[model samples]
Target: MFDTTRRRTLEWLGIGGAASIAGCASQAPTAEDTGASTSTAQSTSTPKPTDTDRVAADPADVPDPISRSESTHHDITLTTEEVVAEIEAGVTFSYMTFDGQVPGPMIRVRQGDTVSLTLENPPESQMGHNVDFHAVYGTGGGAVATTAAPGEANGMEFQARYPGAYIYHCAVTNLDYHISSGMFGMIVVELPEGLPPVDKEFYLGQHEIYTDKGVGESGHHGFSFENMANEQPTYVVFNGEKYPFTPDRYGTLSVEQGERVRVFLVDGGPNYSSNFHPIGNVWSKGYRDGSLEPPIEKHLQTAKVPPGSCFVGEMETPVPERIKLVDHALSRVARRGLLAEIDVAGEERPEIFDPNPDTAGSEDEEGSAY
Candidate 1:
């Protein structure tokens, strides 16, 4: 049977091809889509590639799809602790996180794997939160999974049913509170088996935090999924911490002229949009919205990462140097989100080697954010 919801979302993603969707698509896709549409169908949204549309893709460039695998189970524990006892730091708020990180840890399993998660929330009481995984076997990932009661944590189990990227977050109190409080992450349920691991992978997601500044001691903010569409993160980030915090933890990305760097941006917490920038350019665009679709070739400075998405792109740093990665939104980059570095060194380039800032444009509006 055809799925009307998936059809609408796919069309909106500019999939199937819409050149220049950098602008909005005039009309919405209809339910009549039979999946008979060509993979190369014009977006009817973006500008068609010029007469020189088809670029000769070298077989060497397109690596083979990694063999996906399936395993019986994957179990893990996630905890949220206040770094400084009762005091809140950074944005001056104690957040609900997994494994002590905002976006939590990156978990991968085969298509049919049985993944179990045990959660632990800190003592400081707030709204209760629970896990709701999109890749689970039923009910949009167990939204009915009763939330953890204050200090008490809960456990849930589900089988990976699909072979695409799926999102997991605290769907505790509707789509409102939990998400805004920084409770979300992604699980790449490998297709049956598992996809090949790239040279390097990093997990980052957009987050929304609710806060009010006070002249006295910094007020502890209460983050929730409220006004996420409007109150974007004063800070955007990679993994859990901000820029400098990443290098020592996740380490810096090192690459040569043609090595491929896979950057995985998952949205576990729903709030801010993530902007990822590689020094030179993205060498490959293999997956979109968590599935292995086709190869996209883009060489730009800033890349927008949406929620529930796990986009894999490549980077070929022209020369060895320090490259900066930040949320494309200037304010968040400066405030509470994520920032990091890449070590690109010892490289030489041909005549056409250069960096262009005026490349990719952020065309997507705020409400339909990632």
Candidate 2:
């Protein structure tokens, strides 16, 4: 899948010519050129209250995905910083984050609401940063208006004119590198009537990590510019870490049987698309690319979530089982360390799923079906 996509990307780049992209990628921004303020007074001042303060105060601090509120103005703040963190047990990489988390905070608003967004590049950040919201309809999707340098900040106001889940990511020069390094998130503009409530909601972001080292290599890994340009990644992971959702590590997503679950997924791919699928379950209702219109695809086995896009899918857990979430790209799961699990706990429904039916009279107690 990546090979095909990489060929296409290369073809597109060749035909459109890489001159412009090369020019953009070549001119790395310097602190002076980025207009980072150096005033002593500004340096000593505290950060101003962001829009999130006025409304959804400190909502980004939590991991639970946020839901839409009543139609109104929303103030959202996103700060950019860089951190070195473990990608897996032994592998580590430098990540560019929003508000100190990969995939950033889930920003929710209703169609027709006004969004006052603030983008800040902290003093500790190493480069300039900006945001491009796929839901917006203006130049670079508000990127041009919101580019901020280290210690600097910028703001933009736009109406949430559409109802959908959209991808938002850093749009600075060499955006592919920035996004691949973990500088993206999702913004949900819900319909006026709102979506049907579910028993659980989980947010996940998918992005590939292009490291100079191979997977599982210990010690700090550095970004591979060559691999990124060729669309070859060493790891494709969820929530910015390898297999972080498994019970053996952080914990598995738990829910009762018969409960409805909604998974909000964002693919921050600087390159490949995601063939998002759950191993033992299907999307009972799917809002592809966050579309809120009628004719939502039902009972979908998998959905294509492209780079700079979002998907909202609901599942009905009818049986007690573990559902593995994966990118059907296969290689990502089989090789690149992409995995998540949802453990459904409740009384077993033998009528629906009988694992021991064939072994009822068998003498092989060790081989009882499960």
Task: Give all candidates' CA lDDT scores.
Answer: 0.48, 0.74
Summarize candidate 2's per-residue lDDT along 1-370 as a digit string, tens digits: 0121222332322323334232245554333432332122112122222222111112113243335456679788888877766777655666788876778888877788998998877766677677888888787787766766666677789998988999999876668778888899888878888888788888888999887777776665767666776889989988778777776667777889988999988899989899999988899999998797888999999999998898999999989998888999988988887888899998888888876686586565574111
Prediction 2 TM-score vs. true: 0.81
The C-alpha TM-scores of every prediction are 0.63, 0.81
Off by over 4 Å in 1: 1-70, 80-91, 120-126, 151-153, 174-177, 214-232, 245-258, 268-272, 275-279, 293-304, 334-338, 350-370
Model 2, residue 1: what's the lDDT? 6
Highest TM-score against the true fold, candidate? 2
The ten-residue window of minimal lDDT in model 1 covers 51-60
In candidate 2, stretches whose alpha carbon ends up further than 4 angstroms from where it belongs are 1-70, 359-370
